[model samples]
Target: MDGLPTRESSPGVVVLPGNRAELVAIVRALAASGVPFVARGAGTGLSGGALADSDSVLITLTRLTRILSIDPIRRRAVLEPGVVNARLSEAVLPYGLAYVPDPSSQTACTIGGNVAENAGGPHCLKYGVTTNHVVALEVILPEGEIVRLGSHAGEPW
Candidate 1:
């Protein structure tokens, strides 16, 4: 919340709520606040995707980390943006389950960031980028509409 960088060339910071309902509230406030904001994960983004402007608010999603559920029968996982990529595999290993999309930053990068960038790793040559594995995304549109994008059909959003 505080002690966050807010330089003109850097990004600003704003505290966010911890749960989905609170996230919705923040999104609504952001839409109406007339302030520019960018969502961030582990700050592992190499592209300009996670970068922010001086007037922008950096909505770090690190606090949203969680592995809600993993369905081995369905070979699917319901996860929060803050979940670490490799952690998913480790968490679901006993179930004979594994996440297909694994990036180089799998140990530290949040799954949410991987989704945002469609990240790829060495294994990507065989498995493909993050976009190839994602099913559905519960997203907040620009107008603060929390909508479900994509489907459980393993399509890109």
Candidate 2:
């Protein structure tokens, strides 16, 4: 089950990766074994993306909540996928900055899920969505190859 009450799913395995290294290893093993897997960040969406079938594995990002760095000058942050949206805003408040998407579930939703789906809230009309704020992405491919998309200064596409 994810955020929606009517929705339900059962994964073959549930793994909470403690760090990027563990995550890469898990992904590699799963890929090598030909097991399907889905990455979940906070499991806070009604979209059911976090839900995985019994034949697939659910890789939860909850334990990866570290906010790696905050650059007040660029109003940017280097964060782990599980960093809560509201927490980001709170963390940057002293710098007179904010994570503006602020979806209704900001308190529970995460940067990874937001970035994955380009999330937005009512303020999107004025501030635009998550994509407007994301300058780059560091992703792990299905085969466990790590790649950085986009440039530090702007979006890739």
Candidate 3:
């Protein structure tokens, strides 16, 4: 059971820890192997962003799904990249706080993918796109460096 399911050189997915420690390990492995890979969310992507290529690693972030913090007073929720879009909003709904952007695939789409694709949904017609609600981002770059992209009080881009 510890072995891979297929004997052939088939596409594979690795589930790593979703914490900071695990993130470091994942990055280290990718860096050491010098392999080109793609970071994927719920696999609800329509742009083929999650498709595996030759010798390409698909780093699944689904296990990282967690709502780290929610600010009812500020109407903001800080979440892991793997957190589903609709779930985040649902978590805050009781407090009258909601994530404005709602992609068609919000139920399955992840925050990471939405941010990467910069998606917009029907609700965006009045509220705006993903970037509008996102205040900040903690991204693990290709080189395995963790970087904070923006601030909560400032522009997202």
Candidate 4:
């Protein structure tokens, strides 16, 4: 929701990519055509950040949900953008670990939106927000270029 600009008008097109490759291709085509687009996770945001203009393209990340890996020993997890906030903690609970950023909307909010908004909840009073727990991010730039930000190895540098 952090990227969209308008709420009243529906986007001209809405795409839900099942994987990263499809997402990249869609982005590339949109860029080539000079079409404005917005990436959306869940529609659970309180702010109108997920709104789009009538001429814009909305790329919903819901189908991209996947927990790539969970390293309990390292206390880290690799996940796709559409992975739900609470679900991550539940998945790792069996490993005797948990993702700490528990926003009130965790039940329905996606991890991507939590990262976008730096969301936090009652637990944040002691644990901190999404950014503090997220170790890495695989992002697609506006020009359709994919890049990795942060290190999966958990090294800040």
Highest TM-score against the true fold, candidate: 2
lDDT of 1 by residue, 18-84 (tens): 7777777777787898878888788776676777777887777878878998888887889999888
Tens digit per residue, CA lDDT, model 4, 1-157: 3423444557888899999999999999999999999888897776666766778999999898899988888998888989999999899999989888887778888998888778888889899988888777888998998888888679874
Off by over 4 Å in 4: 1-7
Model 2, 1-157: lDDT tens digits are: 5786787898988999999999999999999999999999888787777789999999998888999999999777999998999999999999998889978999999999888768899889999999998888899999999999878885456
Q: What is residue 5's positional error in candidate 1, in angstroms? A: 16
Worst 10 residues of 1 by lDDT: 1-10
Cα deviation at 151, candidate 3, in Å, is 1.3
True-structure Cα RMSD, model 4: 2.5
Question: Each candidate's lDDT (Cα)?
Answer: 0.78, 0.89, 0.75, 0.85
Give TM per candidate: 0.87, 0.95, 0.85, 0.92
Candidate 3 global CA lDDT score: 0.75
Instruction: Report backbone clashes per prediction.
Output: 0, 0, 0, 1
Model 1 regions more than 4 Å off: 1-8, 153-157
* Candidate 3, 23-84: lDDT as tens digits: 76787788888977777778776665566665777777887888888888877678888889
